[model samples]
Target: MELSQAEIEDLLSRAAKGQIVRTDFLDPAAASFTRDLLRNYPEVNYKVDGGYPSAERVRFAFFPIYVFPEDVELNIGFIEITGNFKFQTVTHRDFLGAIVGTGIKRDKVGDLILIPNGCQVVVDRDLVPYLIQQLDKVHRVSVKVKEIVREELLLPEAKTREIVAFVKSLRLDSVGASGFGISRSQMVKEIEGQKVRVNWKLQVKPSYEVAPGDVISLRGRGRVEVVEIAGVSKSGRNKVILRRYL
Candidate 1:
């Protein structure tokens, strides 16, 4: 629901249990809607999420809004999403990027970004109908209500080098294939063409198995799967290390 800062504050104050998820996205009418909600309802458990778009995923890439009852746990969920709306983190960099991409110039004030991951929302079940009504008039945001499950960490105790090295050892063509959906050859070409770097240094080899303490940087695919070679290979053809980007 759109809400003014004052109205939001008032609503929050009146809520016996309250939560708000801010995004970097903004609608001119959002603040006013928020104010209206506060004026009408003293207790509002509003859960909002938002984020920027990524080439990696399409659905939750747009500015998205969602709500669940306040009893739900706020945990980071990692799932392949498919829908009309996408999400990303709301940061100064994200805001400027949106402005540049959309060619929409507006000031950033109390704007929040709803990352596709790393965020959640909670609201009272009874308030959903009213929330949906307010969202109908708010532009640039599409709201969906879903049961979310948080992502389970694979190696919580593993270090960066361990992660990268483990991925490299996956015997995939490239780090992209292992961590991302891209192929190994594609990753190699990007690096060999001076598009890839290890610890920020130009790297051209796709088969260059990552080790612990190495930071592999790809131009378009993003950086990953290189760390210091923390351990040696048993057959001498493989090694183990942690990835800087897990």
Candidate 2:
């Protein structure tokens, strides 16, 4: 992947401020051009995707480069992400599913990006600089996207008692409001009926651990994403923050 001196300098200047910015160009072809100009900078981070899903793929590569050290005190880092304009409605799931599975269906390189995990939906040739940016010790350039199938969703199974469990911890009704998008009573009833899953496994206990990668599917309601495990409450219960998608 190659970037122009101006684009490279722009990314470096922003990285100095600890801001993660996806390049505004939004062109995959620009990534190749940018990669050619990035050879002089060693402190910057970058990735490229070569083996994409389609032929009309804009001849673009997905590039995500992070400029934060692992041992840094802050949790955030600067990321310069670039991609070509493809289609919309492309969710983060589409990106991760492509990288970890049999690749995205039919659609060619849509330049998708999945957050939380920060995995890039990329083509085959653009994988080099990306690996260089993420790995610290070695400079192995050849890496392939391997597939691992999960017959069923796993982790982050929702339970009927989770509303009460979160309520018990924070003494707040927001969990009921934010999670189920319904009344607390409705949440209690739904959970008790064994309608949730934590990490793709059916979770019956309301107090089950809502770890990352868990998807909670409510029959009437929509899915909720357990984005992260923030921290423990003063009451000693697990504090799992979730984002429900309606």
Candidate 3:
């Protein structure tokens, strides 16, 4: 679902008066809706940020047109959680459930990046202290959390592997199967089940044509991107190169 209309309207109203209004973290669909809403108010200056680069969840800040985005302060913080990983393993779900269990809205939290020692949580700077104090145990493993500066946040690099596919057409089912190393029949099932997203928007039609630079994602599966189309081959088939994210 998109952000609440009343909440957005309130932020816009206050932002029109030169006050900087900020929203909690939002997913892609919600961020898209907010971006569309802001287009109608050209007088409001806005910035979207997720504390670090390539953050999946981000927040929006709105201010008067006279104020520059850099002038607005963004209160985002990181917390490093260390525990006995050798004896017990902690996953994203475990850390997420533990933090959510502490009564904070999931929107208040951003990404939780796994590191060698443990996972680093991105959250609103104001909640750093509370999270460090309340978050003690994760997945039955005792843990310790400490506030870390923005510079210390460990963001992983995106790794992708190139895959080659020959299909009759650049249809979603054909190319997606090759990109994700799944069978065409399985790809069709995924699309029909509302588990496939093209560029983050759901695409149910298996026949949808995908172009270079388009990103296709299957829920629970990593993303696949069309890197290049090598044109028609001598066998009357199209050669495509896909980048599968790991």
lDDT of 2 by residue, 1-246 (tens): 234558656775564455443343224345444655556445455443232322112332222345433322211112212233233334555443433343323223334433332334333323434433443211111223222122211223334323222434422222433566677566556667876544334555554544564556666676666565667778876566766654
Arranged by TM-score with the best first, the candidates are 3, 1, 2
Poorest 10 consecutive residues of model 3 by lDDT? 1-10
Candidate 1 lDDT tens digits, 73-171: 322222211123435224335433432333333322222224443223222223334333333211233334343332321212423323433343533
How much is the lDDT of residue 171 in candidate 1? 38
lDDT (0-100) at residue 70 of candidate 3?
85
In the order shown, the candidates' Cα RMSDs to the true structure are 15.9, 18.0, 2.9
* Count of steric clashes across candidates, in order: 50, 37, 0
- Please report, in order, the local distance difference test score of every candidate based on alpha carbons: 0.39, 0.42, 0.88
- Single out the weakest 10-residue window by summed lDDT for candidate 1: 55-64
TM-score winner between 1 and 2, please give it.
1
Error of 3 at 197 (Å): 1.2
TM-score for candidate 3, residues paired by index: 0.84
